[model samples]
Target: MRLEAVGRRYRARGPWVLRGIDLDVPEGALLRVEGGNGSGKSTLLRLLAGIDVPTTGRITGRPRTAYVPERFAATLPFDAAGYLVHMGRVHGLCGRQAAARTEEWLERFGITGFAGTALDRLSKGTAQKVAVAQALLAEPELLVLDEAWAGLDTAARALLDEAVTERVAAGGTAVYVDHDPRRLAEAVPRRHRVAAGRLTDGPGGADEMARVVIEAEGTGEPPAALPPHSWTAGPAAGAPGLLRIRVPADRADAALRALLDADPPWHIRAVRSTGGTSPSGAVR
Candidate 1:
């Protein structure tokens, strides 16, 4: 899917929430959208999900899409299971298939007990699970999550993570926004920041390329041929043998694969963004 100079606003003369945006949402891409509050991140997502249209410019080649909005309306007059089954059907699943998927998701989210319970009667977290399930049941080609992890328990949050990984691995596209910077920080390759009604590539300014920090512990030497433009820090105090490796965000997966595929794999401790740090001693 592609957006060409897309712009959006509530009214014709109202200030633009977003403008001068051009983006290419490739198949199988995992993109992250970031911004401050009232910065049009949600607006851009709604546009991608077809929940809202651009007031100016054009969007073309959108695929089959599903979206979990920031605020899910749990007041729908249907039981949790019934609602999911209906959503599945709307996404082109047959009756039996829809029912089966509904059961599977409810079980996965540990909400099977509430399958027959009315949506309006469920707790906030439970309702959020139902909202997430409705989107994942049909495996839409494009999935948009707007803070869908909020209100979910740790187990359910992990389940959503696995589901998204599966979706992208199966050649689908997923876009999301979350307050937690560490949420899927290791997997997402493309990140765009929305600010002042405009979109900028990467997590920050053009000169400040995003970087991934990998903390690992290894007995022997680090893996051969670590990704280029990467650096390693000597072990820190109180943590002997702890290797802090930093690489450009785009090469993070490659760096990880090399480490994991070594003769004796390195034990990864943590992975996070550098924010904006440029240490010396680049790996050859």
Candidate 2:
């Protein structure tokens, strides 16, 4: 899907929550949205999912889409399986196929035991599993997840991760918003941020570009556990045991994790992100 100069607001003349959002979300692209709270990140996701329309500018090329919000209303009247089956039909699935797919996803998310349980009785984690499962039932061409991992357990979170990987591998477009910068850090997804009423591309530079400055104090060189290419560091000029490392933002989390996990853990003084700036959230 494509958005050109898009903008939105609640009242006809209320403050615009998002503006000038020009983005091209093609098939097979996994994009991550970031920013502080009330930054209009959720508004952008809603627009992309067709839950709301842009009051200004235009959006086009939307495809068969599915969305899982941060919170799912688990107080519905139907049981887990029945609700999924109903949603499946809404997504153009026939009864038998929908039922089969519901079973498949329920079991995949490790929520099959609760499949027959009423939605209102399921636990938060189980309800989250159901939310994710419902969105995947149709194998949608576009999947939007807005903090869908908030209440999931580790295993179920991993299942959702795998589900997203599979969806993108099948040429679908997935856009998500999450508070954790490292939610899918390993994927090295296209990054975008919502801030100050504008949507802008996240940090980016050449592979050799250093986006994170890691200052630490360690006894020796980096352990063999860390890949050589992940970072480059040297002892602080005159300060013994002090090391300064520069790493790419995409690998910063893993790099930091590895550093802290070493035998004699390195004491991290500070880790600061260093990169380009987005002016007024224009897509560049």
Which candidate achieves the best TM-score against the true structure?
Answer: 1
RMSD from true fold, candidate 1 = 9.5
Per-prediction TM-score, please? Answer: 0.74, 0.72
Model 1 is weakest, by summed lDDT over 10 consecutive residues, at 229-238
**Clashes within 3 Å, all models in order:** 0, 0
Writing each residue's lDDT as its tens digit, candidate 1 over 1-284 gives 99999999998799999999998887756788988999999999999999999999999999999999999999999999999999999999999999999999999999999999999999999999999999999989999999999999999998998788667644577899999988876554468999999998875332244456677777677777785324343432126666665566666777778888877888888776543344333321
TM-score of 2: 0.72
Model 1 residue 132 CA deviation in Å: 0.2
Query: For residues 110-144, what per-residue lDDT tens digits would candidate 2 score against the true structure?
Result: 78899899999999998888888889999899999
